[model samples]
Target: MKTLIILLFFSIISIASAHAQSNTPAKAEQEIIKLSKTKWDWMADKNVDSLSTLFDEKAVFVHMGGSWGKEREIAVIKSGSIHYKKADIHSVSVNIIGNTAILLNNITLLAVVGGNEVSNPFIVTEVYVKQGKGWKMGSLSFTKINQPAQ
Candidate 1:
């Protein structure tokens, strides 16, 4: 009877551990989604200081008109050259592979570039890498979608 009880207890612990492991990925996915939205908000607000911490030093950004590294991206944001007025996020999804997370956000972005207001639909891909206790954005690319925003 004691042996049976011990086995049962062990089985319960194993099941609990497995459940916890399963939830971990979901939690991470949610975290990545939240971070991605926050990034859009920061960009719209031109909060370069906050964005600087979230962006990795070796990060790259690809816009429709150009591609650049972290320093140039930060400079552009600071200068309000291409002001991110708003990001209407329609949908977001996240995929986790090892220590890297890929987030895709379908959005309608309103921007003021060259003193002209423009809106575009895009699929924004954001790549984040786990760095110690936090995650840093390593790459961000916007691919313009032919269809209109839903």
Candidate 2:
């Protein structure tokens, strides 16, 4: 009877452990998606303080016009060199691989650049890495899509 009880307890523990492990990726995905949306909001509002925390010091941002590091990206946003007026997200998906999370967002971005407003459809790839207790954006790239926004 003691052996049976021990086995039963071990079985319960194994099942619980498996369940928790399965949910971890889902939780991370949700977090990544939430952070990505918050980034868009911050960019539109020109909230560099908030963005500074979210972006890693060595982060890279690739825009249509040019690619730059975190400091340059923040400076441009603050100076309104490329104002991100709005981001109309069509679809978003996340994939977590080990300690890195990759997020792809299909969006139509309305922006003012060089005193002219333009709208463009792009598939934005955001890469995040686990840093201490939280995740920080390591890289962001915008790929202009030839197809229209759905």
Candidate 3:
């Protein structure tokens, strides 16, 4: 009777552990979404210090015009080159692979550069990795959307 009871207890524990493991993807997705919004807010306010905190130490950013490391990206933000008049993001999808996550999103960027206004639709992919206590973006890439040919 005692052996049967022990077996049942172990079985229950195993099932609970499996259920917890299955929720990992959903939890990771939520974390990424929250991180993305926070970073966007920081960008909207032009707070380079706050924005830099979202990126990992070895993060890489591949922008439409250029590519940069974490330090270089922060430097440009500090230089006040990339200013957002109205930046909106939507259609965010998150996928997880082991400890890495990929977040794909569409963005509408409205800005003024050298007195010329520019508004464009762009697709962005941000890679995040779970490091230490929280998740930090490890890489970011953006591409412009071209209109269909008539």
Judging by TM-score against the true structure, name the best candidate. 2
Error of 3 at 22 (Å): 0.3
- Per-residue lDDT of candidate 1, residues 11-116 (tens digit): 9999999999999989999999999988889999999999999999999999999999999999999999999999999998899999999999899999999889
Q: Candidate 3 residues 1-150, lDDT tens each?
A: 999999999999999999998987898899898888777777667788776777888999997778989998887666657665665786799999988999887888776654577887878788999888788889988787884111
**Candidate 3, RMSD to the unseen true structure:** 2.7
TM-score, every prediction: 0.95, 0.97, 0.88
lDDT score of residue 81 within candidate 1: 97
lDDT at residue 29 of model 1 (Cα atoms): 97
What C-alpha lDDT do the candidate models reach, one value each? Answer: 0.95, 0.95, 0.81
Off by over 4 Å in 3: 147-150
Model 3 scores worst on lDDT over the 10 consecutive residues at 141-150
Sort by TM-score, best first: 2, 1, 3
Q: Considering only N, C-alpha and C atoms within 3 Å, which residue pairs clash in candidate 1?
A: none
Instruction: State in Å the error of residue 12, model 2.
Output: 0.5
**Per-residue accuracy of model 2 over 29-119 as CA lDDT, tens digit each:** 9999999999999999999999999999999999988899999999999999999999999999999999999999999999999999999
Residue ranges of candidate 2 with Cα displaced over 4 Å = none
